[model samples]
Target chain A: MELLANLALGLETAVTPTNLLFCFAGVFLGTFVGVIPGVGPLAAISMLFPITFYLDPTAALIMLAGIYYGTTYGGSTASILLNIPGATSSAVTCLDGHPMAKQGRAGVALFMTTIASFVGGSFGIIILSLFSPLIAEYALTFGPAEYFALMVLGLIAASTISNASPSKGLAMVVFGMLFATVGTDSQSGVGRFTFGSMSLLEGFGISAMAMGLFGVGEILSSVGATRIAKIDSSSAKLLNMLPSKDDWRRSWLPGLRGSSIGSFIGALPGTGPSIAVFMAYAFEKRVSKTPERFGHGAIEGVVAPETANNAADQTAFIPTLTLGIPGSATMALMLGALMIHGIQPGPTLIVEQPSLFWGLVMSFWIGNLLLLILNLPLIGLWVRLLLIPYHYLYPAILVFLCIGAYSVRANPADVLIILGFGFVGYAMRLADLPAAPLLLGFVLGPLVETQFRRAMVLARGDFTDVVTRPIAGTVLALAAAILVWTLVSAIMRYRRGMKALTRNPTG
Target chain B: MLDRDYRDIVAGLGLTAIGAAAALYALFNYNLGTFTRMGPGMMPVSLGIILAVFGLLIAFPALSRSGDLPPLKIRPMIVMSISIFSFALMIESVGLVPAVFFTTVIATFSETRVPLVSALVLGAGMTLLTWSLFILGLGLPISSFDWPF
Candidate 1:
């Protein structure tokens, strides 16, 4: 009954004139970024960060939430249509999506992806709504030790989830922590690594770091290279969008399976959509009767990963909203945006700010509906957008990147920060270091430190309390298990590589 | 070019220098309070040492992996970096329009050189969009066409 009334209040807020408009704008911008290669929703949302400072907090969050899931849906369009992923999470979609496009089934692939996205997204929201309140109730009892232990688990999970070697990912996390320490220390009011710069006093701005690493870094790497997308114009017609009855028969079950997998992974504090989509794809291939057809335009192939990524996209909010812990790098950015608006996220968030939580939830369903209407009819338009040269695309992006950074503090120095990190980000890409974990580290490092200090003070410096308290101890134990697991696996993998190299000497 | 097999070692060494520097700085500069009452220096010093150790772990290898560092596209990167630097200088000094115009013009050269007319048109269009989005829609305070001189 309470849930219904809360949802009713949410619906009322979501339908308001201003909220509706921003939701439409946010999702529209999200899909646009998703359709374009080399540009991303991370930078786009970062661009919106300064803009959100002026809007009502609820409206701001609603619009940002729209962008979050909207990008996941939009990302698959590029994967299916052009064999390119608009974001890293959509990489698995290319496995079968491109194959389907090659087989002149691009329209069907696009249509299935939309339907699957809606289904998986709805599944995630339903689960998020049901679980968040209960989780928040539990989280209200947590102390500083619990929060610190939870953060340890979250950080370890984030480092190990990246596809790169585990050791490199751990190094990136420490590097991120180092960067996060650049600002003035909140407790003692002393600068840690500021190098006496006034700008460093506030720390590295999340907007500048996100835009520099993901946006400008991407442009710098790819702007010089030229690539053309091949679209099957005939299969791109509206008629081709209605998947055959047989196609629908094969889709629903896989969509359900993928949604379950995606939501589960997404709810974990550090694992994200990229891991979800691959797991979903692997699950579908494993369970199929004819595994041989897994990568060759299998409609199931297209539906499952699409469903999984969107599901992960929606459920990823659960950890961020309920626990004050980000489920993914994007969630960390979202949490940063919320913090900038002076809205604290955590257990008290739902109990204290019910409207903001419920209203944003309602707007997500509306945004998904708008996407269904937008995606199919506008397939031709999106394909046309693919043809716009990157050289042309990148210049406009550069201007926004600058404007967005400047709008942060109305200081031009933020733009310089982006340039500095842009070079660093590009260098990381060259070195095959993952940027996602870095964002996580930068966002979560301070939180972990504060909690650790507070817990220590409360316990009178007894470090053993971290392991003796039941919930905190259990959580920290899990973190220890994950750390040991990753280190062991990394060592085993290294040894296996050495053995292979020794056994296969070249003539 | 640096050997491909030694990339991890190089990366690890770089991180070690960075971590050691941070750790040494933290060691000298701030109060290292006890564990029960951690001072501001506690987290940085601990993290710096961990980073240095991790760096050494990454660096120590028998080196059998094979992955080449892709040649950096120096031209576009240099041009783009310069354009951004110039924009940072121009935005506060000249104003939004000229900062955008000049930056867009230089940024285009990062890929293929565009004709002057086309570049000018793009610059104008971008300047219009930035002004409208930041000043008009979002209402950030800044002059649209100030003369820095």
Candidate 2:
């Protein structure tokens, strides 16, 4: 009954004309960006972030959340149609999605992915609505030591569980932390890395860093390499969008399983849709009767990952909203946005700002429904958007990125920081280092430092005492276990590669 | 030729240099207070040491292994950097219109195949759009055209 009443208040808040309009605009812009290969939700959100300052906090969060999930819905279009992933999370979709496109089953793939994504997203939303309040209530009992231990786990997991080498990811995370220490320290009031510059007193602007890395840096990397395969226009027509009876029968179970996997993974800190989608794809393949057809226009293959990614997208908010620990770079940016609005996200956020929290949650459902309405009939329009030459598109993106950075603080210096980070970001990409962990670290570094200091104080400077507490001990143990597992896997992989090389004896 | 992972070696060394520099600077400049009442320098120094250790961990194994370096397209990097630098220079000093126009011109040419006519057109179009969207529609405090005498 309480949940019902709370949901009613949420629906009332979400249906306001102003909030609804911004939600639509956000999803529309998200879809536009996601249909274009090489641009992701991160870039799109960063680009539009400056404008959110003018909006009411509730509306601002609703729109940003809309863009976050809307991308997952639109990203599959490019993967199926052009074999190019519109977002990093959509990369796994290209495996079977493109094959389906090749076999004139593009319409069926697109249709099923939409339905699967909706089911997955709804499941995640249900989990989010039910679990977030409970999690927040439980998290209230956490002391500074528990928070510090949990943050350590998050940072280490982010670095180790990625596609990059663990050391490179850790290096990036540490670099980000180092950068975060630049400004005047809040506790001591001493300038650490300011170098006697006034602008350095505040450290770097979040928008500048985000736009530089994900926006301008991405454009630099993708400039001469973007490829778009011709999409069959007929497949996008309404008449062709229906899946066969057999395809529908095969899709439902995998969709449900994908939703379950995605919700669990997404609820955990330091994991997101990219990992969830890949896991779902592998799981579906392993469970399939005819595994030979796994990558060859398999309906289950397309459905499972699509559903998982969308589900993961919805649930990824759990850690960010409830505990103020963002699992991914994008979630970190969302947290940054909340901080910018002077709304501190943590256990008390739900109680203090119930309307804001519930309104944003309700907006997810509206946004998902809007995506379905937009993608089905407007599928032809998005395909045509692919025809816009990269030359034309990149210039506009660069312009918007510069303006976005500038508008953040109306400071030319911030624009310069964007330029500097853009170069650094390009270098990181060249060196095969993951940038996501760095971003997560940059946002969370200051918070982690504060918690660590508090924990030490509470323990009377006895680090061992802090670790001996039950919650902190268990969480730290989990972090240590992850590190051990990563080391073992790395050694095994190296050994396997060595054996393969010895057996081949090339040349 | 030595069969070594140049990418890992170079990246590792770079990380080491940065981490060591930060640690040394913080140690010299800031106070490293006791754990109970920690100073600002405590976090940076520890994080810097961790980073340097990770760098060594990455580089040491690669000394005996072979790995390919990723392709570096220096053209786009240089071109985009220059254009953004120009935008930063002009945006506050001169105005938004000139900044957007010039940025559009330089950024578009990074493609090399963009015709001169379309580049100018895009510049004009972007200038107009930014002026309208940012200044007119949003009422941000930036002036559309501020000619510095």
TM-score of every candidate? 0.97, 0.96
Candidate 2: residue pairs that collide: none
What interface-residue Cα RMSD does candidate 2 give after superposition? 2.0
- Tens digit of per-residue lDDT, candidate 2, span A1-507: 878777788889998998888888878877777777777777777877877776778898778767776666667887888887866678888999889888888888888887887888988998999999999999999999999899889888888885558777778888888888989898999987999998999888788888888888788888887465577878777788899899999999999999999998888877788889889999999989889998899999998998898888889889889999988888899999989988898999899989888877888888887778767878778878877888888998899888888887888888878888887888888877788788888998999999999999999999999889999999999999998988788677667766765675450
**Chain A TM-score of candidate 2 vs. true chain A:** 0.96
What is residue A310's positional error in candidate 1, in angstroms?
Answer: 1.4
The candidate 1 chain A region of ten consecutive residues with least summed lDDT is A39-48
Q: Which candidate is the best by lDDT?
A: 2
Instruction: Write down the lDDT that model 1 would get.
Output: 0.83
For candidate 2, the docking band is: medium
**Candidate 1 Cα outliers beyond 4 Å, as residue runs:** A500-507, B1-4
